[model samples]
Target chain A: EPEVTQTPSHQVTQMGQEVILRCVPISNHLYFYWYRQILGQKVEFLVSFYNNEISEKSEIFDDQFSVERPDGSNFTLKIRSTKLEDSAMYFCASSEAQLEAFFGQGTRLTVV
Target chain B: AQSVAQPEDQVNVAEGNPLTVKCTYSVSGNPYLFWYVQYPNRGLQFLLKYITGDNLVKGSYGFEAEFNKSQTSFHLKKPSALVSDSALYFCAVRDMQRGNKLVFGAGTILRVKS
Candidate 1:
C-alpha cells in the first residue's frame, strides 16, 4: 500500500540552529498535516496544509515553525531556531479527504 | 472544541481473551471518530474510523469499534487477543463543524500477554 514517507529517521541539532524535516505524502492525497509527540506525552497537532497553503494551525505552531509544499511530492517543515523543548517525534500525515489520514514513520528531532 | 478521552491509561489482557479499550468523545455537531495503533518506535497506523452509518465499525487486524451516540463513546474491541496486539492505542475525534484537524486522546497502552 502507498504510504507517507519521511526522511532522516533521526536528527540532532544544536539549540538556536535551524532544522528541516521532509515528507513525501501519498501522490493522490490532498490534505497534509504535521503533529508532534513529546516523550511520554500526547500527540499534539501542529499545522495542516491544503491547496499549497496553511489551512489551520494550533498554538504549538508558532512563528518559528513553517510548512511548505516545495513541490508536488515534497512537504517540508522548517524550524528557524530550535529550542530544547522542540525535541520530539514529528509525524507527517496525509489524507485524500478529511475523514481518515495515513501517517509516516516520523522524524525524531533532538535539539541540544 | 472537540476532544477524545481514553479512560484507561493501560489495559492488560491474556491471549485468546476478548479485549476492549474504552474511548469517550465530546464534540459539537456530528462526530468523526478514529482509532490508531502505534507499535514501539513506529508511527500511528490507522485502525478504523466512524463517519456515518452503522454504529459498529470494523477495521484492520480483526479490530472493531462501537459508536454510541447517547453515551458519546467509541470503544475498540477485539474478540481474541494476541501477544502482538500489545501496543499503544489512541482514540481521536474530528469536529465536522470546526475544521479538519484531529484531536487525539492521551492514548491507551494495551498489553496482551501470552
Candidate 2:
C-alpha cells in the first residue's frame, strides 16, 4: 500500500533556530493535516490544509508556525523560532476525504 | 463538540487469549469511528472504520470492532492475541458536521504476554 512519507525522521535544533518538517502525502490525497504528540501525551492537532490554504488550526499553531505546499508533492511546516515546548513527534496525515486519514511515521523534533 | 474516550490506560492479556480495548465517543451528528495501532517509534496504523454499515467491522491483523450506536461505543477485539499485538491503541471519531477532523482518544497500551 502507498504510504505518507516524512523526511528527517529525527531533528535536533537550538531553541531560537528555525525548523522545517517535510512530508509527502499519498499522491492522490487532497486533504492534509499536521498533528503533534508530546512524549507520553495525547496526539494534538496542529493544522489542516486544503486547496493550498489553511482550513483550520489549533491554538498551538500560532504566529510562529506556518505550512506550505511548495510544490505538488511536498508539504512543509516551518517554525520561525523554535521553543523548548515545540519538541514533539510531528505527524503528517492525508485523506481522500475526512473519515479515512493515512499518517506518516512522524518527525521527532528535539530542541535544546 | 466531538470527543473520544478510551477508558483503560492499559490492558494486559496472555497470548492466545481474547483481547478487547474499549472506546466510546460523543458527536452531534453521524459518527465515523476508527481504530488505530501504534508500535514504539512509529506512526499510527489504520485498523478499521465504521462509516454506515453493519455493526461489526473487521480489519487488519485479525482485529475487529463493533459499533454500537445506542451505546455510543466502538470496541476493538481480537479472538486470539499475540505477543506481536502489544502496542498502543487509539480510537477516533469524526463528526460529519465538523468536516474531516478526527478526535482521538488518549490511547490504550495493550500488552500481550506469553
By lDDT, who's the top model here?
A: 1
TM-score per candidate: 0.97, 0.97
For each candidate, what's the DockQ?
Answer: 0.76, 0.67
Q: Candidate 1, TM-score vs. the true structure?
A: 0.97
Give the CA lDDT, 0 to 100, for residue A31 in model 1: 88
- The lDDT per prediction is 0.93, 0.92
User: Compared with the true structure, what per-residue lDDT tens digits does model 2 show for residues B7-74?
Assistant: 99999999999999999999887888999899999998999999987999999999999999999999
Residues A23-106 of candidate 2 have per-residue lDDT tens digits of 999999998999999984688888888889988788899999999999999999999889999999999999988568999999
lDDT of 1 by residue, A9-42 (tens): 9999999999999999999989899999988469
What is candidate 2's local distance difference test score? 0.92
Candidate 1 displacement at residue A26 in angstroms? 0.9
Name the runs in model 1 displaced over 4 angstroms: none
**What pairs collide in candidate 2?**
none
DockQ of predicted candidate 1: 0.76
